[model samples]
Target: MAIRRGRGVAAINYPTGMNLGGDPTQALVHSTPTGNFMVTLSSVDLGQGMKQIMAQICAETIGVPTDRVVVDTADTDTGPHCMGTFASRGTHRAGNAVIQAAKEARQVMLEVAAEELEVNASDLETDGQGNILVKGAPQKSISIFDVALSAHFKRGRSISGRGMFLIPRSYPEKETGAMKPSTCYAHACTVAEVEVDDETGEVTVLTVKNVFEIGRALNPKMVEQQLVGGSWMGISHALYETTEPYYPNRDHGGTDFNQYLMPGPGDLAETEIIVLERPSGDGPYGAKGPGEMCANPQIPAVANAVFDAVGVRIDTLPITPERILRALKAQAN
Candidate 1:
């Protein structure tokens, strides 16, 4: 038998954050004596660049340069309260909290700048270049560094703010049972192309093209990396990764990495990603979570591709050659 090529597609709509009794997150924004801003949170980064996204949000909200902002993911003992980072809620929930806190701190900074410049705080605005200037008067300005020094020594005031974001829980309607489970939804579609050998029962993935609507891409490069890496994980789950060889019988299972099966770099497929931005109303700066959704569609897509190639449906994960040959043999009987 010869190898047969096939293509299949899958799509999904993923929720941004859980809407459980106001899943809440808190943030604290405070300016240092050296004019740098600090954002303290209890949410862990988990290597997903949460710290960088929070820093960008805080810096933007406070009208400061991103480099001047630092994010500290301190533990619950030192940082503010946070409902642990899950359900892809880090960016949407914590980001909103950081925005609120940064706004309050920025207000105090403007007030301090107003006092130093002898102008109304309402008329003052930050240039995002470490300077606060009067509207329409570029020459009349005060540096954020001087303002911070004055606030600490001369004014004897601490520039700090606290904020928390909570989405009120929605109750199901008594009659229709309608309820809002999430604040927003992110969408994605993936098309996987593969070749399957009818005789050998082997499958080779050729390419995976994905399109995602993630509300907004705050950091395009990071988004690309996450999506590409996630697609690889999806491919692994679809064709290679497995620990339970004899299911329903727990006797035979992979106990170590050497015994486990997974795809290496040579097994990776050619991946292409296209990002679409549809800003959410309540999302922080129109940004939503793109956490695990990137790895979802590829599973079903690959499964469907195998069916199209061999005319046999394989429902189990890590569709091994033995399973494919069994399906083919059963079909031939």
Candidate 2:
């Protein structure tokens, strides 16, 4: 009985957004009388830090601090239309829409502030901290809060804007299946190290080293969290998840957690991630989607690692002890 170790690598290019009629998303931005900004969107966050990233983008675009920006993820009834959250399009699609909305709102804000300050609209700049100042004159400035109040009460104007993002459809060539599925692509490479128990045919994944070109991390901490979580999900899918195995006989299947074969937190492997920030031209502030691509290369990397360790190919999933043992026997014969 010996433990064998091996390493394997995989590279993948994942597209962002779907190819269904130029996936579209919408956003709305408005300023309150108190100078705070509000953003409304129909896209759901799903615990992926969507709200935080969107807020940051809105604040930066409108020349306000992050704290002054409020994100309201309203449902379909009140918010604008969205093409759902899959295809890793939330950040790229929704964020861009928010930027557009903020640009419009900022124009309104600057116009109103210019009227009060008696200066040209183009000569005013935001300090990124809720204050609008004159160009080349830091001392001449007005708080956004005051501008908001005047816009509503004295000027009879409302500071609000709307935006929608749509990726134009790329028609496929008649003879070839050449079509752009998404506006941009996020790239990833994963190398996995694993150990195999020759006697029991059990495999243990030790580490996953990853390099990702995510087109800029809107929230780096959130990106790291998704990468770690997605890696585990990939490992679980590659090794333990099965809906209907042994189709003819269903004796081994269970309807609950106890009966299902899945990896627990105890089975998580060490992950080292290197994020390369290459902004996308079409993305908001050079940002791209990073949610779904983290798990893509891990499955293939693990499969190749198993092949390198034991010199046997288990084409099917889970890489179970029985499958390994059977493959070993076939090799011996």
Candidate 1 off by > 4 Å: none
* TM-score of predicted structure 2: 0.95
lDDT of each: 0.90, 0.89
Tens digits of per-residue lDDT, candidate 2, 1-333, equal 689998889899999888867789999999999889999999998998999999999999999999999999868787888887888999999999999999999999999999999999999999998899999997988999999999999999889899999998889988997877777999999999999888998889999999889998988999999988888877877777776666567667657898776778788789889899999999998888888989888888988898899888888876777788899889989
What's the CA error at residue 75 for candidate 2, in Å? 1.1
Find the 10 residues in a row with the least total lDDT in model 2: 245-254
**Superposed Cα deviation of residue 186, candidate 2 (Å):** 0.8
**TM-score per candidate:** 0.95, 0.95
